[model samples]
Target: MSARRSARRDLRRLSGVALTSLWLTSLGLPAVFSAPVSAGAAGSWVGDAPSVRLYTPGREVVSQPFLPPGTPMSAEITSVSWRFTPPPGSARLETRLCHPQRCLWLATPRGQSRALAGLAATGPFVMRFRLPESARPSAPLRIEGLQLIVNYH
Candidate 1:
């Protein structure tokens, strides 16, 4: 009877792992357990879009129609820079990037107690980073945008 119970427990554990892998694969994310995650030692840029692709070395591109809120975006970003021009009189803008195991967030009008308003026509909002080595084509990550408002403004 003890042997039978042990076998049953092992079967249940295996079933759970199989189910998790299937779900991730269905979503197009790399198998989380298949390998160790690492960032690329050599800098590289991977563009984030409906179909993510690696960009040419040292080339930079800006996205149009800044991202909307609650979406996750991922890119194999390299050492580079980018500029953003929010609409005039618009509130603050928020941006974020993430990988399977990590996330980074940035907000505009940084460090000032006063709320940011009336954005200029253009400004430096560069994102520079090396792509994660373990990155595999996952469900196309998304960049989410949020507009912040200040009572004083």
Candidate 2:
């Protein structure tokens, strides 16, 4: 009798899951157990650890220009964020994202992320950085990473 009761409990739980899945599917949503959609085609792109080193003070360091592979030209960039550790000092670091036509300055202090409203990813972007005179030339400034978050139709 106990064994039969346990089986019924298990069956009830399974049926509950199936019913939820069916309801979600009816609403044009993916089931909970379904495979996740791929973000490569249209989703956020995070580029990590470019790890650029800046030697000269006040001289601009430009990274090798790049973009998320398979990203279409028509894709619109909704926002962008940067992550890095600033060289230890009062020296302020300047950063920018540049394409062929223009550049957008990332003006957040302490390496915080910022948003770019409806900025189209027209082409590949290169990271440009410059340190103030207060920066110690003896110590190279390391830009840890950069992340580009994009959304598209």
Reference-based lDDT, residue 109, model 1: 25
Q: Candidate 1, which segments miss by more than 4 Å at Cα?
A: 1-41, 46-84, 109-153
Best by TM-score: 2
> 17-115 in candidate 2: lDDT tens per residue?
999999999999998685655553455665443667788778999876666767666666665565555555636777887756667787763333334
Could you tell me the lDDT of residue 151 within candidate 2? 48
Per-residue accuracy of model 1 over 9-116 as CA lDDT, tens digit each:
999998998999899999998667755434332222222232122233222223332232321133222222223333444333343332223323544422222212
Model 1: clashing residue pairs? 38-133, 68-145, 72-142, 73-142
Model 2 CA deviation exceeding 4 Å by range: 1-42, 109-116
- Candidate 2, position 81, lDDT: 60
- Which residue pairs collide in model 2, if any? none
TM-scores of the candidates are 0.23, 0.57
